[model samples]
Target: MKRIIAKQEHCMGCGLCEVGCAVQHSKSKDPIKAYNHEYPKPISRIRLELNKPVSFAIQCRHCENAPCVVACLTGAMTRDEETGFVKHNPEKCMGCWTCIMVCPYGAIKADVSGKIVAKCDACTELSVPVCVASCPNGALECKEVTS
Candidate 1:
């Protein structure tokens, strides 16, 4: 399966990934309009963290035995068999932060309404994640990883 891999050495932390992510998920598909709405708040499933010598974006790993899936009591989080992507259903979510707490990478984020959790789904509906497409520094990418 393909996963997004980050090279910290090549990262510039421009935050373009966040913008792309918001647009991709937005109903308007417009960054400005998307930012003004309630659904997508330009939430970057990938977060750029910088600490002097180290700087990189953190996102979901979509683990085969995902801890978030196990932590979700409402079955809101599940793995897609076809794509190997961990998916979230807001309708089934109960506003619990169990997945967020259990995720070691701190990738999951709360929706704008704060009623559900949100995270990278590997852009299963699109050819690629908006973050990967919007990255100007070539820091974020979708690549296959072998177990």
Candidate 2:
């Protein structure tokens, strides 16, 4: 499986990763519009974990046996066999937050206004995820791993 690995030692916690993710997922894909003009405000699938002296980025682990996939009551979450990525379908989601409760990493986030959830999709459409690409310090890396 291909996964994002975070090197906490190199992370500066500048939050550019969040900006990149929000812009990439925005309707206009514009950083300005994403932050200042978007009504709902695009959310970043990646989050930075910061402590006074340490920091790192985090997102969905895309578990080999994802609990979110199994706990989704409406079948909104599923793992793609070929890509080894966990996917979420908002249309099928009931907004019950079953998946949220089951996610061990607490990666899934609730979009209360939309009655949906959001998580990392690995930015599969692009060569690399915006979060990883935006890491100025090269703290985030994508690599293949055997599950």
- Give the Å error, residue 12, model 1: 0.5
Write model 2 residue lDDT over 1-147, tens digit each, in one string: 788999999999999998998889888899998789988999888889999579999999999999999999888999999989999998898799888899999899986256889889899999988899999999999998887
Best by lDDT: 2
Expressed as tens digits, the lDDT of each residue in 1-147 for candidate 1 is 888888888788777787787677767888788888655365657777888677887789898899999999999999987778899998899988999999999999897678888898788777877777788888887888885
- Taking every candidate in turn, the Cα RMSD to the unseen true structure, in Å, is 1.7, 1.1
Q: Residue 70: error of model 2 in Å?
A: 1.0
TM-score of 1: 0.91
**Highest TM-score: which candidate?**
2
- TM for candidate 2 is 0.96
Model 1 ranges with Cα > 4 A deviation:
37-42
How accurate locally, in lDDT, is each candidate?
Answer: 0.82, 0.90
Per-residue lDDT of 64 in model 2: 90
Displacement of residue 87 (Cα, Å) in model 2 is 0.5
